[model samples]
Target: MEDTMALQNDLTPVVEMKGITKHFPGVTANNQVTLKLYPGEVLALLGENGAGKSSLMNVLVGLYRQDEGEILVRGTPAEIHSPKDAVQLGLGMVHQNFKLVETMTVAENVVLGLKHLDFIPSFSEICRRINTISRQYNLQVDPRAYIWQLGVGEQQRVEILKLIYRGADILILDEPTAVLTPQESGELSRIIAQMIDEGKSAIFITHKMEEIKRFSQRVQVLRKGETAAVLETSKTTPSELARLMVGREVLFRLEKKICCPGEPVLEVKNLCASNEAGRPSLQDLSFIIRAGEILGIAGVAGNGQRKLTEVITGLDRADSGKVVIQGKDMTNRTPLDLIQSGVSHIPPDRISMGIVGDMSVASNLVMKEYRSEPVVKRGIFNYKEVAKSAKEKIDAYNISTPSQNTEAKFLSGGNIQKIILAREIGACRGLLIASYPSRGLDVGAMEAVRLQLIDQRNIGNAVLLVSEDLEELITVADRIAVIYEGRIMGEVPAEKADIKIIGHMMAGASLKGAAQAAAEAELGEDGI
Candidate 1:
């Protein structure tokens, strides 16, 4: 590491931003921020959501112009007025949500926007070049595969290949591993290492602390739209980075009491469902969540987690299944029916499904109960009661909003999530299904959300937590269920769960199969 740092110190920065400042309505997104990326090194950008990391990067990528700053590429001032200019200057960004045409093949997508392409470009030449880059970086994806036919990790590799194909040497990866499985993330780390070995520099924007430690040479922490601290990754710890990012010490572990599970609250028996593509998603999946117990569903995204949640919450229909809530069969019911049956859902897409962005915070708070008494009386809404309820929830949840009347869309991601938590938890009677509840939140806000889930469990609510984060599930859930291809691969008590076994189950291996495979591998290692 010391030798690598010494070599990097001797090289000019591939990209540099000086005194970069950007502003939006009523807020300064970046307050004279500065960033530098040396050649052949990975710089991990760490920050809470809305802490100006994206805003600063957007300036460099030509998505937004800086109000007061200058950007230098290879020690020369560069004018980047659009993405085309950024690409021409050897800058490419792989955004979190990929911008690929789903119906197009990988080779076609790679050369889609190049101005130098001939009227009838040779796809054979394009595929050959893609194959070369793929072999060089060990990015294994078929060039002829369509975007929709590939897995999430393959799609991500295609995105990177697009950048590399465009002659980009400086890469910006925004939460690259957010949708990947554990094994895929490891593969991505190796790919990035190979890129750096070949003298390519990258700026990795992510919230996960372990990734920062494993993937980058130096770490930059941003707080309140300014540089808080920049430290060598080897010399600093995750706790120190958390403190720098939030301006205070953070508690990584929570105090969760032993669960005293009661009667069954939710039961899904022989459940079957199909995805939007008309393919079978949930295949005879069955589970039982008891009151006072939090049952966590752990799997890679795009597994039956989404479909299962939708079926149970009445957002989607089950082809064949039995959904029993507190001994009452409620299969194929409407969302309102499930709500009336004491089911509360914290949807994954908070902006679209959880809350109406155009509505005021107060109105959104009372959305579920607006048709009931106290909020609605004699066919009229009581504005004072709505405001009173919103005030209590805002204070209780620590939601940082301007006022109750402010539109929900104006708030930050964390605050918007808090609003959903407050509303759902307040209305929860018997069951609460939360999907990736702490996702994209800062350490401080993530801790708050986890503690709230524990609180719900302690208060005798049946909580079905579906998360891609294994550590979070192990933390708060009394028991964890591994889902794969819409079936329950296995269920184990969280206290006794083995991460290796869980990972295998998430990849489609049954519990007994995984155990046997582990035993055989151990025996082989011992030369038995």
Candidate 2:
């Protein structure tokens, strides 16, 4: 640590933003924020969902102009008014949602906007250069592979390669590991280390505390568009960082009551389904969720999680097998049929699937219940009752909004999620399926969502929680079932859940096989 600090003191920062401020319609996204990135180091920018971390980085990358303050590149004042200018000044940013042409090949996408390139560049030469950079940084990707043919991780590698191809020395990755599996995240850490070893600097923006510790040298915390604290990674704890980000003592552990499962609320037997391309997705899958327990489905993304949810909720067809709800066979039923049978869903894509963005909060709150009494009187719509009910739900769920009539799209991600939870949890009669409920939310909102799940379990309502976060599954789920390639790898009680074993299962290891491997490794460590 002493050597690192001493070395930093002797060199000028590779990139620096001094007192930068940016404003939106009614909000100050960034307020006089100062940030510095030294050469050969990874600095983590930590903040809540709406804490202006992205806004500040946008200013550095020329996506948004700062209202005040100046930016310096290598101790020289630099003007970056557009992305092209930022690239010319050796700056690059990879957003959470990747900017890639799905129909184009990796090499074509990499050299798409070079001013020096000819109208029809030499494909052979471009592929060779991409391969060379790929080898140098260990970022492997097929230059000829189309973006649509690659997985999420591979697409991300292409994004990095594009920046490196353009001579970018300072990289900014925004939530780089949000959708990656555990193994993929470790690979990214290696890539970052390689970049730093080659004298490149990075600003990693993330809210996950574990990622901050694992990937960064120093940590900078942002709260309410202002710098909260900047501390060395080795000298800080996750609890301290969480507290700093939320401006309060954040609780990492929740108080969970003992689970007392009741009769089966949902049963799927020998279920089969296929993806849109007619490829097998869920193969002979089966599971049972009881009346008073939270059954968590754990796996890497792109596994059969989405298909399983869709089939069970009547949003898609099942090739073969039965979906029984409350002792009635509901195979291939319509969404309304499932809803009437007391099945509520909080989908993975909240903006597109969970709520209507352009509609008023009051209107969205009563969407599912509008056909029932109190909301509809003698076949006539009741505006007064709808507004009254919306206000009650808003207060109960702690949804932050200016008015019940405000557009749902205008609210922040966390508050919008609350609106969904408020409606679904209220309408839940027998079973509730929540897919990545707390994803992309702040620490406070995450805590609230988990508490709601637990409360549902306490009240004897079954909950099926699907999440890629093993930590979250272990915290709130009573029993977790691992799925890989449309098959159940194994099930483990949450009380005895081991991360290594679960990770192995997620990678396609059966429960027994994973346990045996763990035991063998332990014995080897003991030299037995």
Which regions in candidate 2 have their CA more than 4 angstroms from the true location?
1-10, 103-108, 112-120, 123-125, 276-279, 350-423
Compared to the true structure, candidate 1 yields what TM-score? Answer: 0.87
The local distance difference test score of each candidate is 0.87, 0.88
**Candidate 2 minimal-lDDT segment of 10 residues:** 1-10
Expressed as tens digits, the lDDT of each residue in 186-278 for candidate 1 is 899988888888888999998889999888989888888898877789999999999888888989888889899899999999999997689
* lDDT against true structure, model 2: 0.88
Writing each residue's lDDT as its tens digit, candidate 2 over 340-405 gives 999999988676688999999998888888889899999999999999999999888767566888
Per-residue lDDT value at 276 in model 2: 79
TM-score, per-candidate, Cα-based: 0.87, 0.89
Best by lDDT: 2
- Deviation from native of the Cα of residue 83 in model 2, angstroms: 1.7
